[model samples]
Target: MHEDTAYPLYNRPWFSVWLDAGGNITMKGILAPAIKPFTSDLLDLFENEKPIGTIDANGMIVADGEQLIFSTWMPPIPSAAFDRLTRSQFNARLGKNTPDQVTISVTEECPNRCIHCALPDTDNRESLSPDAVKDVIDQVIGMGTT
Candidate 1:
């Protein structure tokens, strides 16, 4: 399966430059904050180049035309609970976990034009019909999910 299918908002070049009010370029994502003017070297680095790097939830920065890119954030054992527990205990905890019973999307239609809303950007604007909603509730009840 494609990585994009497995993950939402996945881009081949997932990096986005943060810019200040003065139009000066800042570092990628939330990692680097200090703003600096885009130099000729920086422009060259961005073009016709797949700079070898790993950009995770915490982003990264490449400067001075270097091949070896570094991650801004280091993942610690994949989970915070790992630091306090043994491997066996961690496995047991996960094995004993219960998944969420149900997820109900009540409506897709919204009247408000909120600036942050992604719904307006999507093609789908139809909401579930009253009968369809009733059927969903009935099915949920039959499955013993609240």
Candidate 2:
């Protein structure tokens, strides 16, 4: 029996040992998984405490240090509350002559047990009401360019 027959869904490059139709065990493919080392000097660039030269879709990169950059985009906030917080923060920062981007954590009820999470453990979690959230949005838009 081929190992592929036993685990048809396994598409990884390596294969495991399996028994043949005659009940004899045989090595069907590579016994151990292959370890592909990083081929570029990119890893070394980051290792030396340097900033990334360019960030890919996943943000991995190699670059010179001391480069100042700013980016703003919609963050992962609840659909209902996203616009308000985004606008408010944008306005506040703009008023100070330094517009800062904001990233609001809409849902405090995360399932993961991360050690650094700041959410309160109590069942009685407090969140913004729909009407109040709308008010915040109105105030933000009333301010100015975001």
Indicate which candidate wins on lDDT: 1
- How far residue 111's Cα lies from its native spot in candidate 2, in Å, is 2.7
Clashes of 2: 5
lDDT of 2 by residue, 88-122 (tens): 54355446432223234456666676776666565
User: What's each prediction's clash count?
Assistant: 0, 5
TM-score versus the correct structure, for each prediction: 0.26, 0.26
Off by over 4 Å in 1: 1-103, 113-118
The root-mean-square deviation over C-alpha atoms between each candidate and the true structure, in angstroms, is 19.1, 21.0
lDDT of 1 by residue, 1-146 (tens): 11111111111133334222122333354322332232234433333333234233354432322112211221222222212222322234457332224455566677766897676676787788889889986775454332
State the TM-score for model 1: 0.26
